[model samples]
Target: MSTLSTLKDRIGRYGVWSVGLRAEDPARRGQLAEAATELEQLGYGAVWLGGSSAARHAVPLLEATRTLTVGTSIQSIWDYDAETSAASFAEVDAAHPGRFLLGLGVSHAKLADQYRRPYSALVAYLDALDAAGVPADRRVLAALGPRTLELARDRAAGAVPYLVTAEHTAQARAILGPDPLLAPELKVILETDPSRARTLAREFLAMYLALPNYTNNFLRLGFTEDDLTNGGSDHLVDAVFAWGDETHIRDRINTFHEAGADHVALQVVTGGDRDTLPREEWRRLASLLG
Candidate 1:
């Protein structure tokens, strides 16, 4: 079967997106592996490591699960050059073929001192990855805009847009046409109360709001400056995040699929410390989906 077809089969309708899954510390390897195993057992087709994760961070999870596809939600172009990324992809794919998806992105200027000519740099990076033999089908991009989405369609497997609305998903699918993967990362808060949910969503979204890339995209999506103020307005929060009861959240997730997302990478926000795994929330999500 073709690699794209294999990806469609391997990554099911929904997957877990978590920064806690990144195995940066040696001591967390076992815990990370165990969590990955449970996620696989819970019937999640993939686990996307959040933050600027690379193929190396996916090693423990890939090792622990036989079929769960582990991917970097984004390994910034600034963080690792294409040659190093290609080597990591080669090393990981050799150990576990057809199981790793290299998700690349040009992160925000605030985070990367080297951020410049991002679009052009991304093209060059893809060119290098091509020369290094990283199959286009095995990689994805953290694309949010039209130009990058076009690059994702033409150069890579597909687009995995972060912090997008269903409206953006529809627009992206229109750009990508029918073939490549379109997996957008969605934040989920299991809370039912609007007051509590929006508060948590605002707290989580505050950092992203400061970044212009996201703000620009929000504007492009039809949100106003008012919507972007004070973390995020209710309308903006409600649009981007899936919250409330199980049924409500499920319906919200379905909107993305209806809008043309092949997979939704769900990141659960618990209004707690970032380090904890939030396994119970994951379990609830699995059951909710089921």
Candidate 2:
């Protein structure tokens, strides 16, 4: 079977995880392992590690769990070469077959400026990935626009779009056709209070708002200039981040599923300064969603 087909078969249901792994805290390494184990035990299909994490960083997390797919929702294409990444994928697949998904992205002009050649560089990168023998089905692209989405459909399994809504999922599904994988990340703030939830959501969204790629995607989704300004408008906030009690969150996830998302990776947003305490939020969401 093709690698994408294998992924679809393995991740039979849906999955959830934080946006990124919090490896900055040395004390929490054991807790992170335990959390991975618990997430797998709870029946969540895959755990998505985010962009900031290194390819090597996910090894321990994958080793700590069994039968749960560990994926990089994205690793920057600029930071790592396809030959090295493909070798790593081969190593991980040999060690834990059908348990690793590599999500790749072109990143934004601002971020890609460090390496130069923002657009053409990505196409070259994809060619290199092919030349290096990274099978199309084993990887996914972090795409939003039509061109990148088309490239993803032709070159990789599908697309892994972050900071998107069910509406965007439906659009992406239309672009990707019937066979390729379409997994989009949803941010959920599990708080009932509107003011507090929006505050927390905006705080998490601040950095992304500054980034051009996210802003351009939001614009493509019909968000006006004013809506993208000042962190984000109410409509933009509500659409992007699902905030409320358990039932509300459940419905939100189902919205994405119903919109034709193959998998939905949920990022729990808690109203706290310390990232360490997200374990409570993760457990709560796992119980609610699992």
Candidate 3:
């Protein structure tokens, strides 16, 4: 089978583990490599690196883990040219064929404004990737709206919608049909205490609320303007973030699977000042999920 086809099959069979890469973390690089290795040891199918600058942050993690598939939950297409990105992809692919999935995005207009003409620039970028021989199936788009979803279907593997609810996953699945991959990132606080979990959830939601792309996505899913304001309403928080104990988090993951998500990438929210979060949480969760 083709690499993309094999990846789609693997995603269908085994769900994804997506982690964020925060620049603030001191042990970030080591933690990422360790996490990737541990997740692979735990038998998790894939590791998605988020908040990366194109493939720069992802390369080390990919180099560290042997068997696990690694991908950018998104690399801003505006940040790196297709030839450079494709060259990076080729270098990684040469070492680990079919193990790296390229998730590219137009990013938000606010962020894309630094480059000018966001949409047109993204189109030109995609054309460049095509010209550089990055196979359509080897890459996926970070899309949410209908138009971008259509573009993803035509030009890439599929869509990687971030911070989305299961309802939106179902809707996106319907729009993309059955063939293309639909792997949405789901945020989980993993705390048993409601108040504490909500606090962490809101803390994480704060920055995302300011991003228009995410706000508009929530709006399309029926959230009112009030729901988007002030660190998000309780209902909005509950809908976007899955909290509580392990059972609750697992149930939320299963909901997305049942809702027709080919793969659900789990972003585990951590507390305390430590960068790696004790590794025990990841170990326990991996055992529970595995």
Candidate 4:
């Protein structure tokens, strides 16, 4: 197990979350490494590979930076069995040691045909990880519910809850007590106009809106059916996304910190290409956060 005491110091107060970082093409490895290097220089504490990222996906990023921690925002249990996950963890850790975090998740029924009794399956997965000697403190859960949150507290390092509001972070902190990592991914739109920002947020949030895991969490956070419809209401969009001027964005991000998040993984939502890395936007955010 990792030294729980230093997890916060290792992860730091902020990270950059991006699906683009999980590029599988071998040709893009150099570019990805350069981006990782720049992110470390930019003062980001960590890099979370978005989507259903795996432990293998973290290797390149970890190799590209010395101090910056690299985590798979979630490596689905369905995609890799406990044995494979543990082996991958061992391989990566042997080279990078404490720089890798194995983020685990059950994914969704709609996305995985083998999905079954997610809670129970997640428990079993944890059990397997334990048997395979994967340290609890070196991992995290993509938890959104009470039971899973408790599981994160009891079985893993902490949680990396996605698509959640600040209030949920507060509740999760309460459940987590005064320890363990609480890093939630917050979507960001650099646009200042409400209409334009909401449009961009909606376009990106549309797919997640169709997932019950996220929608149910929204409902639990007091959002209504209408709020979940048509790519979410403006209120819902505004709550989950930081999309205004620099001052407003800073305040929005601070709310999560105030609510007890150890770190906030910022995911920039752009109007242009989704696959390409938003380096300019990242630079803007680095300056804004600084």
lDDT of 4 by residue, 1-290 (tens): 33776988877899999999999999999999999999999999999998899887887888889999999988999988999999999999999988999999999989999999999999999999999999999999999999999999999999999988999999999998778889999999999999999999999999999999999998999999999888889999999999999999999999999999999999999977667899999999999999
Model 2, runs deviating above 4 Å: 1-3, 19-28, 273-277
lDDT: which candidate is best?
1
lDDT of 2 by residue, 1-290 (tens): 86677787777656664644636556667777887887777777887786544456567678898888877877887788777888888888788876788888877666765766655777888888788777788788888888888888898889889988788889989989978998888988989999999999888898899988899889888889999877788899999898898999889888998998998887887755534436667778878875
Residue 125 lDDT in model 4?
93
Task: Candidate 3: list runs displaced more than 4 Å.
Answer: 1-4, 11-31, 272-278
Please give, for residues 56-110, the per-residue lDDT of candidate 1 as tens digits: 9999999999999989989999999899999999999999998999999999999
Q: Higher-lDDT candidate among 1 and 4?
A: 1
Candidate 4 worst ten-residue window by lDDT: 1-10
**Which scores higher on lDDT, 1 or 3?**
1
RMSD of each: 0.8, 2.0, 2.6, 1.2
lDDT of 4: 0.92
RMSD to native, candidate 1: 0.8
Reference-based lDDT, residue 84, model 2: 82
Q: Write the per-residue lDDT of candidate 3 for residues 151-251, one digit (tens) a residue.
A: 88888888888889899889888888877888888877768898899888888788888888899899999999999888888899888787887788888
Comparing 2 with 4 on TM-score, the higher-scoring candidate is 4
The C-alpha TM-scores of every prediction are 0.99, 0.92, 0.90, 0.98
Off by over 4 Å in 4: none
